[model samples]
Target: MSQKILMVDDEADLSKLVAHHLQKEGFEPLCVSNGSDALKALAKQPFSLVILDIMMPGEDGLQVCRKLRNKEETASIPILFLTAKDEESDKVVGLELGADDYVTKPFSPKELMARVKALLRRTERKESASSYAYRDLVMDVPRHEVSASENRVTLTAKEFALLEHLLKNKGKVLTRDHLLNTVWGYDYFGTTRTVDVHVRRLREKIPLLTDAIETVPSLGYKLVDEE
Candidate 1:
């Protein structure tokens, strides 16, 4: 089945243009003129991913993204922000708000399509993996569930992906850039700080991981056995 991509933008011309390109790329593109309609559409149906514009008539992209992340049913859907704002702060805020990627205005259609493919590919790859375990932490890929020390651990989608990567490479030191490229995909424009944030979250959720996940100053993180 063709993946459904929700394009939420107030610009009619741009939204139509993007939707055309998305269609050519083998995706079913659905467009919404405002954040309000975007939320309504999202609640009514499922989309493989969301292409959100930062500025809109009502609740804006950031607000919509925040609400999506806060809701369990829609939280895991990947969000890519399309905005005219290119400031570092804006990009960082979008990433922190659970946006998987960001594209500035006047972007090349080729690049945008490439990023869309990358994001979708990463999500599919993670979701298709078999269940894995590291000591007491078990990751159930099909259900997108995780448990540590026999207790359920609630993690955001990104956190779950990061933990799964660490578990797969236990005993190997993974640099921040490596983690960003591997877990977030190379199309992600954010810096390595995102890796640190997710790592901290994993440690907090699974206290046992605090001792197992080692911090190598000036390098990166390593999932190693506690000595």
Candidate 2:
């Protein structure tokens, strides 16, 4: 099946033109006129990517992106924001809202298509990995499964994220603030205790990892003895 892409914009003619181009490129385009309809469309379809315009009648692209990211099912959906707003802050806010990319108004069709293809390629790469491993420890991200010593382990999103971070940087000592910001996001600050909670839970899940990950006391943690 061709990859499905959602286009959310109140500009009917512009969306239709883009949809025509997208369909020509072998994507199934679903067009929505407002944020509510966009959310509804997402709830009903498994779109490969979303092209969202910031200026819409109802809720805007920012709100839609933020809400979609909050929902577990749609959290990883690739979003490319289109806007007439040209300020640097607008782009920054869109990115912080979890938009995968942004395009300003008057963007060339060729450039837009290139960005769309690039975003989808990146998303496909991530989905292809979906899982990471070190030794007997496995983190199946899409399935949200973690295991060690040939047994399944249950972990919270935070705990699994922490473990994934450590395993990815197996031999490095990641600072508390770095882990906190990366996994929990920069919106969460001052409560460094959250990192400790996740680390403790991760250790509980993989007891053998107890020694693999060493606490630097007041500093952070490191995964050594890597496989």
Candidate 3:
């Protein structure tokens, strides 16, 4: 069955163009002009992914993303922000808000499709083990759950994937490029700063990881294995 994708954008022409490409790629695209209607569509049916625009009439894309991330039912759904805001701060804020990917406006349809496919692929991929652990932190892969010192820790999809990769390669110095390719997909168009943002978030979310994840200046990060 074709995957269902929800697109939230005020631009009618752009929405139609995106829908056309998504259909050609064998995806069922549903376009909504505002965040309210977008939420309505999402509540009405399940979607494989969401393409959201930052600027809107009522609630903006960032607000919508926060609501989705807070809701248990929609928290796990992957979100890609498509907007005209190309500033580094904007990208960092979107990523911090639980958006799996960010694409600035004037984007190529092909690259957009690539990002869409990458997000879906990441969500659908399965790990061999049911869970992974490092110190007091435990990650239940299939269950999509994480805990530190017996306290539940919530993480966005990208954050979860980032931590998963780090735990899998504990003690190894993973380059930003390597982490980006492995966790964000090789087709990811973002820069290494994306890795730094996520790593900072992970540290903030899981206190146990604050000091555990060592930063190699001018290089990348490493999750101390302490084995």
lDDT of each: 0.87, 0.77, 0.91
Better by lDDT, candidate 3 or 1: 3
Greater-TM-score candidate between 1 and 2: 1
Where is model 3 poorest over a 10-residue stretch in terms of lDDT?
A: 121-130
Candidate 2 clash pair list: none
**What CA RMSD would candidate 3 show?**
1.4
lDDT of 2 by residue, 115-216 (tens): 788766544424554577787888887777677877877553445566777877878889999886776555432246556655765666588777888998
TM-score of each: 0.87, 0.63, 0.95
Clashes of each: 0, 0, 0
lDDT of 1 by residue, 1-227 (tens): 99999999999999999999999999999999999999999989999999999989879999999899878778778899999999988987887777878899989988999989888877774445789888888889889888877887666667778888888888999999999999988876667877876787678769888889999997899999534
Model 1 alpha-carbon drift over 4 Å, by segment: 126-128, 134-136, 148-156, 186-190, 201-212
TM-score of candidate 1 on Cα atoms, chains taken together: 0.87
Q: What does candidate 1 score in Cα RMSD to the true structure?
A: 2.5
Question: How do the candidates rank by TM-score, highest first?
Answer: 3, 1, 2
Candidate 1, overall lDDT?
0.87
True-structure RMSD, every candidate: 2.5, 8.7, 1.4
